[model samples]
Target: MNNDLYQEDIKQIKQQYACLDLTDDQAAFLLRHQNEPYPTHTEYYLNTWEHHDYEDHIFQKILNTAQFDHYLERREARLATHIAFLKQQDEEIKRNIEYKKQLLSYYCHTYVPQLLQTRLQYPNPFFAHRSKIRYIKEEYSNCCKVWKLRVTSQHFRNCRNYSPQLFELHMLDLQLLNIMPDYQQFKADADMPTQTTLTFLLDKSRCYLADFISFFDQKEAEETRTKKDAAIAVFGKAATSGWHIEPLPESNEERSNRLLFLLLMIEKVPDNGQANSCY
Candidate 1:
């Protein structure tokens, strides 16, 4: 409710959404609808994008969150209902966690102790106490922020390492995660022009997002065609189809950013191979 704090949080929201290449109209939509959930940072979207490392901010907001989290959630606005729904999910998870803590602690002290004593064996102190402690410890493990992270292993090469005004490949996964919904919306609507990465909008020289993505797309296509053509030319099937893409090259970290989004795109797909980029 404090006007000063409200404005400051709004600044954070704007900064977080700045990575996307939005069209004039899409930009206006976000500009008008920017006043929803108040997050200290946008990294949370990285996890929600199915990278499995979602434990970042939810716990901090909900751990000591009994009174405090609700206090912030009470701040009202004519927000995008989707964002509000996410906030509500956070609240529900928080309540469930708090309830689990209470229930686990209560059973750890009371009926569980009595149940252990009931066992006719000499003594089950390990089951009654130590095992219980271990179970509780494992239970709390689920409360962690880092669930499963697979992207740290992957890497990619791009044109430029340093682009201040534009979103680059190294940072694409983070911003792209947030705009996946907008990407779908763009497909359903006719006014938006199709960009390679969907939600991404292009600017002057900041990073021609469509061209950049297509460059990789076409390059991969050529390589696939090249190897397959060679293989089919010889016999029924080639011994190796994708051996050329191997032999990874190294680059400067400070000046270069890997196209982590490629890995992220694969991550979104189902292991059963039933879906094309799970989106």
Candidate 2:
């Protein structure tokens, strides 16, 4: 692994590749990499001066010359390999970048605006969702529309308004309750309001586990279809408006309860949206 085994060969290699103007460094590179693979650069470097016991001055004279000495054949080959890898994975890298970019755009334009909507003296279906009479809306309207509700988040610097970050965190909490052995008991605990709590759970009866567990799925489908019809009547034009009613992702009892929780929260918001509004 050290230069000891390669000590004798260094001179021989320099002599063989001399036609290519090999330096002591280049000869050492050729001697070590003659096998053409070392898992990666780490493995190749690990077997260098430390393993070889070559004197510091001797080793320094012949270490990694290809980076500065372009004449070294390995330099061109390494660059070519890296460029080829970049080209090969370009599409995947682009998709990943684009996905994050879209998430940021959503955060800026949709999520943050909703949280601050109440302070803007706005009405339901947020002002930001529009552009000069456009019916701007949030992406997911299947559940209790947070933009249409008055939820609070204590974690985010004591925020109190329509907020999706709070909404998602609440959703995970609901999912947690849904998977528990005594889910109803946990759901009940989440329902009971605590003094000084930012969030107030309302209409806890609607979120009863029995409704989802005992009811036939056909009944749920029928209700879903009816809601879709109403949504079409409200925000039908896909070309202009950004909403259409569709099936919620396949959900369990927990998701059903989550939707019920959102609905109850929306219902709890006062009817007087503008008159003496919080904004």
Instruction: Specify the highest-lDDT model's number.
Output: 2
lDDT of 1 by residue, 133-236 (tens): 33322322221111112222222111121222122222233223322212222234323223332222112111423334444455445545544554454333
Q: TM-scores across all candidates?
A: 0.18, 0.24
Please list the residue runs of candidate 2 whose C-alpha ends up more than 4 Å from where it truly belongs after superposition: 1-74, 118-279
lDDT of 2 by residue, 61-122 (tens): 55445433433354356546654554454433433343333333333344333433422332
What lDDT does model 2 reach? 0.37
On the 0 to 100 scale, the lDDT of residue 214 in model 2 is 31
- List candidate 1 stretches off by more than 4 Å: 1-81, 123-279
lDDT of each: 0.33, 0.37
